[model samples]
Target: MVSIKEGNSPDTETLILEAARKVFIRKGYDGARMQEIADEAGINKALLHYYFRSKEKLFDQIFLAAFKDFWPSIKSELEQGDGSVKCLIRAGVNAYTDMLMKTPYLPAFVVSEINRSPERMEGLLQASGVDAAFVMAVVQRGIDRGEVLPMDPRSLLINMLGLVLFPFISRPVLSRLFFDSEEAFMSFVGQRRQEVYAFMCRAVLHSSAL
Candidate 1:
């Protein structure tokens, strides 16, 4: 969420956000402290409180921004009939992988919260105005048009979510077991973006579509 371009001086709010993101990535929601974030930003606690009254509000702001950055504008794409289902799949997977590369700890943080309180986050997607029926209808149209295999939209969506999230969820164990170093693990993740797109294409797209 720290979107300041190279060589630009970040404003105080931007600095705070960047510092909070780093602290959240390191300590997670429960472990992160407001004072820690202020220290990370090289600012005093009073100033931090003036900008963000509470830890929850600050964390919510950062997490929500990250989520928005993570999700593609597929709703608009489908509405405009801008791309085939396969194309959308590829774009979505690419976007997801790229976002994870930038915010590697996000999936773990979300999964931890969901495990702690399932009801707390159950309505997030709905609250975001992502209509399940509308997305299903779009997928159904792809099936009717033979752009993809005749699979249930729910199954396709769940599978895509699993495929995209599993790597990040298991990164701690997988990184230790499969990679020699942090750089190697990151390199593998970078390569897996294309692999995920290709795999999903095979899983859902018709031969002609591929």
Candidate 2:
């Protein structure tokens, strides 16, 4: 086990973070212990503390890192492009769904932890800088451009996200409901990845046409 040394290589921080991410994903935040993280990092618990003061702090770093990874694609899509609202929505939908697929445990972890600590949600919201207003502006632009049918932007955004996220979040139940076994459900999900994008595009186009 190689330990991360201080006053030397900054690359060691990345190693610690990668190790912590693995442990957290495997054991979950609540189930993960400091000693486990230390062992995974190949460092002493004291050194772990030196890098990240507490379990909560370490988890926060992981959470923020995950959030940043998820957020930038959508934000960049919005800020860039030719100001095509439909394109923005499509890009955002793809980015968000892709992130969810890559990090399936993310939603469950964030939602559960936020539920336990309501105040944390506010900080997260502020940090992400994504609120109802921003989503609504995107939807409103689509409406103005006659690219989407008239509807409450908030409701539309919610519905879109729900359609994309609920299936993944409830994969176990959804799998059982629609398929005979877990394997079948996963296969279904793999197929639905494309289906979801197509469905979303059609739904938005249909709404705009109406």
TM-score, predicted candidate 1 vs. hidden true structure: 0.79
List TM-scores for all candidates, in order. 0.79, 0.78
Off by over 4 Å in 1: 1-10, 75-82, 131-134, 207-209
TM-score of 2: 0.78
For residues 1-210, write the lDDT of model 1, one tens digit per residue.
Answer: 346665434577789999998898688888898889999999888767778778888887876665555455555444455557776676667667767887787887767755766775646665455455766776788899998898888888778878988878888898899989878888888888788888888989889988
Instruction: State each model's C-alpha RMSD to the native.
Output: 5.4, 3.8
What's each prediction's clash count? Answer: 0, 3
Model 2 per-residue lDDT tens digits across residues 1-210: 335454545665776788888787667788888888878888778877777778889888987776566453576766676665566656766787778768866666665666667787778878876556666776788777787776777767777778777876677677778889988876776666567667767777656342
Supply the global lDDT for candidate 1: 0.76
Best by lDDT: 1
